[model samples]
Each structure stands twice: as structure tokens, then as C-alpha cells.
Target: MTDSDIGYLTPVIDEDGAPFWQYAARGQLRIQACASCDELRFPPRPCCPRCRSFDSTWRRMSGRGRIWSYVLPHPPLLPGYAEQAPYNAVVVELADAPRIRLVGNVVAAADAPLDSVDPELLSVGAPVRVAFTAASGGVTVPRWLLER
Candidate 1:
């Protein structure tokens, strides 16, 4: 798909996710590593999910993972995602975490719908990794995929 399809990637840019996007623009995948317990967190937050420590550092990730859970959005789902109905919204278990999960999309196009990836090719525990796409104002953010 063309870049025109990646229209809704506007990251809210709150305290947590801003740095992650900043790094993504440079083609780096970042995850929050807790300074206290050394746990890696995703969906970006200040505190570590393990130790609940406010101290953390942004660690560059290997950008590799496996599908932990997933779903196909169907008719009568979230209206914004209806056009992309049957799109896969998956929770991936980062290789670094194995226990921690990151929710993202699985599509042929970074911004395309779940339908872009044939359901036959998707399954729990499938290999996946982080990918990036252009976003508003020339920024970039992470998207998920079945292949590199």
C-alpha cells in the first residue's frame, strides 16, 4: 500500500510514548527498561509493571517477538476500525519480555487493515516483529508484522 494509507498514526505524545516515537523515526525500536527491577515495559509508561518503579530507561529492542494473542475485528466493532473490519489487533509477547505484551496491528501494509494479511497466515505464537511507518508532521511510529 501507498503512504497515503497511514493516516491515523498520530501518537498522543504524552510523557511515555514520545520518546518511543522519536526513536522509531530513526529506525530504532525502543522499550522501557525499568531501572529498579530491570523489567521491560510496553505501551509506554513511567512506572515499571513489575516493581512499579518510576525509574526507567529507554532500551533499544531487537524488534522481534511472537504473537501472544489476537482478534479479528468484525462488523459492529469500533466504528473507526470498521473499514478495516476483520483486521487483526494482536497482543505480542516481546522476545525481551516473553511475559510483557504490546498491542499492535498485523497487516501487509503497516497501516492497512487486518484483512491485508490473510487470516490463514495468522495464528497464535506466530513470529512477528516491529516495523515503522510515516506519520503526521514527518514523524514515525511502530507497527507490527508477520515478517520483517
Candidate 2:
């Protein structure tokens, strides 16, 4: 099946996470940070857990990370992704922000197919970098690439 036919689900953008998608569209990896305590946060929310402040700003990251963990699914959870079964779904721990982690697929290139990389190459603590791809509805999703 073609990449278009793989039908990856588009993210559900909300007020709290809008800026993230915006930055991703521009090929930048940004995380929400607390203006009060200087703490970085993921799954961006309005309030800062450390300072109990509602103030926050977007911080650009190095776009560098390491695979904290990964899995290759069989009999894909969604029928639309079945053709891409065995793709690597990875949990990446950001290099700059150790406390934050993000889940995404690891592909050979920015816009490559989900299963483009061999599953055997995946491992915990492997270095990776962030990549982005435009999705349906003007949203951009982050993908990962192994650091050479």
C-alpha cells in the first residue's frame, strides 16, 4: 500500500497544544516551558505544576533525543495501519529536557513510510532526532530518525 493509503490518524489539536503543532509545521521542535520556574513541560497545559503559575512560553529544543523504549506491533491496532505493521513506535526522551518524553514513529526519513526502518535496529537509548510531516487538516506530526 502507498503512504497515502496508510491513513495515519491526525492529531486532535486543542488550545493548550496549538503552538506545538504550529512549530512542528515549521519544522521546529518546541516544548512548553513555565515562565515562572523555567521548567519544561510536555503535553502542554495552561498551569505550571512546579510553580502553580499559568504563565508559559514555547522553547525550541535541539530536536535531539534518545529512544527510551520501543515496540513493533503485530495485527496493527487500526485497520488502516495494517499494511504498515511492524513499524517502530518509540518513546523518546528529549536530550535537553530529560523529564519530558514523547511518543512517535521512527522512520528512515522525514516523510518516509512508518515501516521504512527495520524493526531490528530499534533499541533503548539509541540516539535519534526529530522530524516533521504535514498531516490532514494542516496539522504536522513529529517523527523520529536515527542519528548517524
Candidate 3:
């Protein structure tokens, strides 16, 4: 696997979140769900916040979402992303789970630089689809592509 050129920070995978990353490696967007309550959640945890159950499962999302909000950072806070300044970081609300939002960069294509898309092109409620890119340490990170 090759690391993305943007050098974006890698996600810290924990026991509860491993499955999500595993699915992403295969280009699937899976979210953690409470087996008991049937509620979906992100930033996976061992216990369901709603039902307080230890049983959990992963649900594959449609990979479809809307850009709930976005920002083009003038000077990226992270040093590694400095070269990719003016790139967009978007919060996408899943079409299947509106309350489950994911934060990621919107690029022109999978593996494209963070700033690949023009900042002026982004807007709230813009349609987007999930794209995965290999990042440092054999981890795949999710990015977004504007659905045009």
C-alpha cells in the first residue's frame, strides 16, 4: 500500500474502531451500530450510548452523504498539511444516518491532493460520495468526492 501524498494525519485505530478501518481498506464505509438498540454511531465505542449494551456490529453505509458544512483553512493547523492549505475539510451527514457525520477532506478523486478541488466549488448541502486512500502505516483513510 502507498501513502497518500497529502500527508494528512492518520487515524488512531483502537479496538472499538478497527472494523471501520478494515472496511474502509476495501472501499466500504461502515459505521458502528448497537446490536441491541439498532442505533448507529461513529467514533466507535465498546458500549452503546443508547442501550448501554456491549454487543456491537458494523453496518455498511451507502457511501452517500451531503456536505453538511465545510471550511477552507487558510493556514492548516497541522504542519504536515501546510502545503495543502486552502483545502476543504467537510462534515458529511450520511444519507442513511443523518445524525452520523464524518469529517474528511473533499478531493477531486481518490488519492488526489487535499486541495484538488476548487474551494469555490464547495457549498453546504452539496452531494458527495466516500473515497478511500491509503495513508501512512498501512491504514486507509476516507476522503470525499463531490458528486457532479
Candidate 4:
């Protein structure tokens, strides 16, 4: 089935997180970095959590990471996610910035379905690399692929 047929949820981009989506559209992975302390932050907050600095910059990442954790969603799924049940949602810790982790799905390729990868293959600390998929509403999301 096509992506639209699966009815994937699109991210709600706000002022603080707009840059993150924009970078993803350009096939780049960036995180909010505190201008003062140079600490990277996730979820795109306005101020730095470490130093409480409002001034921040978008820093490009290496797009390489290791799986920190994961979950396989069961029944009672959300409206658009039921068809993709048994899919794995992973938390990946960036190789360059261990403290910064990103949540995403692990697929075989950029356009693969959420449940493309065998669930039995997923493991914590498994090396992964980034892949981008263009979702609805002109947004590009970063997904993960198992590194061979």
C-alpha cells in the first residue's frame, strides 16, 4: 500500500521545532544546541535544559547511532497506526552526542513500511543509520536502518 493509504501521522511543526523538520526535508539531521554551553538538546525546546540558555543553534549530526531502547506497539492502537501494528518504535542515541536520543521507526529502506524489519532482529545497542521518508504535509521524517 502507498504511504497515504496507511494514513501515517504527520508531525505538528511549531516555532521551536520547525528548523528540525526543515533540515530533515533537506536530508540533514540537526538538533538544537545551546549557544552558550554548546550542549545539544532534543524535542526542540526554546531554552537549553542544561544551562537554561534561550539562545540556541541548529547543529548538523552524523546520522549514526545505536539503539538505546525500543517498543513494539500492540493492540488498541491509535487511529492511523492500527494497520502498522507490531511495528517497533526505537530510541536511538546519537554516536557523536550520546545524551541526545531520537525516537523513530526502523525500516529496511526510506520508503519501507513501519513493520518492514523483523521484530526479532531489533536489539538494544544495535548500530543503526538514518534514513529519511517524506510524509504527508510536505514533511520529511528521519527513520533508522540497521547498519550491516
Q: Candidate 3, clashing residue pairs?
A: none
Could you give candidate 1's per-residue lDDT for residues 3-68 as a string of tens digits? 234434345667787888789889898887888888777777877778888998888878899998
- Best candidate, lDDT: 4
C-alpha RMSD values across all candidates: 4.3, 3.1, 2.9, 3.1
lDDT of 4 by residue, 3-120 (tens): 4544666788889999999999999999999999998888899988888889999999999999999999887256577777778999999998999999999999999988899999
| Candidates 1 and 4 compared by TM-score, better number | 4
Model 3 scores a C-alpha lDDT of: 0.89
Return the TM-score for each candidate structure. 0.77, 0.93, 0.92, 0.90
lDDT of each: 0.75, 0.89, 0.89, 0.90
After superposition, candidate 2 runs with Cα above 4 Å error: 1-6
Residue-pair clashes, model 1: 1
Q: By the lDDT metric, which is better: model 1 or model 4?
A: 4
Best TM-score among the predictions, by candidate number: 2
Q: Give model 3's TM-score versus the native structure.
A: 0.92
Q: How do the residues 24-91 of candidate 3 rate in per-residue lDDT, one tens digit apiece?
A: 99999999999999989888999999989999989989999999999888777676678878788899
Question: What is the alpha-carbon lDDT for the whole of candidate 2?
Answer: 0.89
